[model samples]
Target: MHLFDKEKIYGDRLLAVDDRDRNVTYDQLDSFSGELYRKVGGKKLIFILCENTIESLSGYLGCLKTGIVPLMLDSHIHPSLLNGLIREYHPAFLYIPKTCIEKIEDSEVIWQFGGYCLCERNEKMPPALYCELSLLLTTSGSTGSPKLVRQSSWNIDANGKSIACYLEIDANERPITTLPMNYTYGLSVFNSHVLMGCTLLLTTYGVLEPDFWGFARKKRATSLAGVPYTYQILKRIGFMDMDLPDLKTMTQAGGKMPPRLHKEFALYAKRTNRKLIVMYGQTEATARMGYLPADKTLEKCGSMGIAIPGGRFWLENEQGNEIIEPDIPGELVYQGKNVTLGYACCKDDLIKQDEWKGVLHTGDIASRDSEGYYYITGRKKRFIKVSGSRVNLDEVERLLKEQYEGIDFACVGTDDNLTIFMDQLILDGGEEIIEYLYQVTGIGNRTAAVKCVDQIPKNESGKTLYKELETTADNRIQSK
Candidate 1:
């Protein structure tokens, strides 16, 4: 059940095709990964700066095959964040692009794969990587947070199999890259496709990019997966009208898509004889937990649907008691092999055992219907999905203060936009602050808004009353 084991049975078949249409066969991937394995495989822990390229995939497969725990990161990560991660984890090796190696000094280049360089860390201490630890990913979207989701090889395999089963992915499917390789949703696509011997089309172009659609058309891509934000872009680009004849399956996750958009796409799928699957997941669950079946899309338009095959979802009240009655909002609880070991905030936390114990207390407020379909009401966590990436409002506020001193601001959001409510609005500084917010959170400016306020609504305990801010956001959106 290894992700790449199908290569043995499908050696000559196309496993991946890059934007250039340079197809890589299963045998080619095997041989390339073998070379990478021999070069950088022995490291106890390696930091892989990843892009959606053939070499990045090879390095990832190589690390997994050789038992090297790889902390996959975005290739274009901020230098300060990368430095913070390096200082915290002290990985034994750094697999980075050749152009980016200059930022990392005191390292010897041991191997090169195309444009990527694998360098051994200098003065490296042997990482205390747990026996079960296979991957470390930031729970927050690529915000350079030290907090990470700890996953075992079993977690990846189980989740991939479940996703493949529900999505009906097979060797004939061709899934094009729509998100960053560092993102869990994107990685899940890679894992599921690889496990099923499917041809994965790799591209760096984004969903809004014309080149991306052109490549999809050329490759005759059969399936596509995206976060809610991606669907927003699809709607903006008039995706339903596009002539993608080979597209049979479309998946949405990461955050709740607007009910209107959900119905829009579902109707489009129905008209075109396609499937639009709305899924629910988090990084802590190794990418997926629930998915709404195509047949139930219109009937249960906004529901997250039932748990995926091999997974179970229930609800628990604030007192940790089970909630079984329909329409009762409670925290969504999931139990599955895909549930991660635990979170890691620093290096010492890596050796922590499976603290989650196969049960993930997903900090989401949801309700189940009579038919067992779950619908998200809100989030318990102080995170917002901006363009498919989780942006922690608290973290954003902290960074905003650091970026601009004495500016009291509170970050709040509706599903589609992040509004920065500032107490002291600096003249002509709105766009600048918005730009900084985008830089820090990876949320685009289109979804970021700034509003001047007399005061930030706060409770007596000095806590910014986010509920008040949310009301303001709702009013603002309604006015627009």
Candidate 2:
């Protein structure tokens, strides 16, 4: 079913609360969206520079209603990058803010929507899009790669339904916006809540900002979603001490949270009679594959839990054979209807059908317990050979986390050494941790060093920018 199809039934229900604290009803959304649909309908491809604003979201929903495929992109993207994408994709129309309009001044303005402008290209359109292709989203990075994950209407519907089912979302639930809508996880929150007639609380303020919690409290938001990095910031700001009586559930994803942090939040949720749900997925699978039940948080502390409804998880060996033995680590795999059509590198790739079938090889190293719960250990590509022994960098980082409670560490391996970067200078036992790593791994102490920085570089979702760390490591090796 279409996402907006429910608006007819919930016409007068409040659909969303904007950053300015303005409430928008379903009737208002439908009427405004109808106006937008008429102005930009029948476009083959539309590029939307999206923010968490009602206007952007309404325009997006309108595109869906009119069967216009939209490529949702971060509004804060650089002008050079936007130009590069436009040159590569040749989208028929661009819906962007008026402030960004000057950057693409060569394009002709087709329509105006208050603070935004819709620009059109007079040149030849890109190749014909596949019949089922509905949306295009960039992979989670700022590398300016033309690569985008192609998703179908089925993918969106299945994922949204599964999320709503497990989260028990309904019309009364208000989920606060904790991430950018361009990101798959963040976008899924919007999709599922909107589908269920739930209210969306929108804001651009981060966890560190006082306005974020203020808005959440003012709106009486029932749910809050965040990446591991968001939780880290929450913990730093003493989230446990905050009086959030109305908050009913908290969800986390994006990356593996340290086990300690997981337990800490689980205990808090248990004590406060709330739920702290942990979920797992990638953009390729349309945002969710598995979710850890809140009731089992203490029992399955670090587990990624079982697959979500309508999805199944298994492990595969290097030979592509299924791993039946429990507690044995292997590459995690998922089979679900939410799997995307495939990746698109250029405009021509949009015409291709589903290449993944119904399966995805999630390149994560994980082990399933006897109860069928999955626990991600590390990534396949994030490993290196040190002293003729293979060592997963994430494993080393996990070890460091276990040893040091509150410190942030990123491990990267060079040709001759494995370096651990810390976000703060530890006055006590930093050397001891290095010695411990050398002792445990048998890698020489001389081959390992610890460097301190003010903070670790991370994207909006709290994912470590390992490429940046690799670059720093390479430069340090070169300079030495």
lDDT of 2: 0.85
Residue pairs in steric clash, candidate 2?
A: none
Q: What stretches of model 2 exceed 4 Å from their correct place?
A: 414-416, 426-430, 470-480
Stretches of candidate 1 off by over 4 Å are 41-43, 382-480
* Candidate that would win on TM-score: 2
Predicted candidate 2 versus true structure: per-residue lDDT over 1-480, tens digit per residue: 467777889988888887786677889877876676676656488888888877787777777666788988888888898889888888888888888886774688878866788887764866589989888889856556799999998999999999999999888899998898788999899999989998889887887899988988888989999898788888999999998878999999999988998999999999999999999989999999999999998999998899999999999998999999998999999999999999999989989999999899999999999988999999988888887778889999998887877888898876457888877665543567667787777766667777776677787677888767644432122111
How badly does each model clash, as a count of residue pairs? 0, 0
C-alpha TM-scores of all predictions:
0.81, 0.95
Candidate 1 residue-wise lDDT, 1-480, digit = tens: 377666689888887889976777878877876776677645488899998888788778777766789998988777888888888888888899998886785689988878899898774565588888998888655567799999999999999999999999888999998877778888999999889888889998887789999999999999898876577668888898999989999999877766777899999999999999999998899999999999999999989999999999999998999998999988999999999999999899988989988999899888999999999876677777776766667567767755775456778776667888877745664777766666766666678777766677742113366656655442232112
Query: How many Å off is the CA of 316 in candidate 2?
Result: 0.5
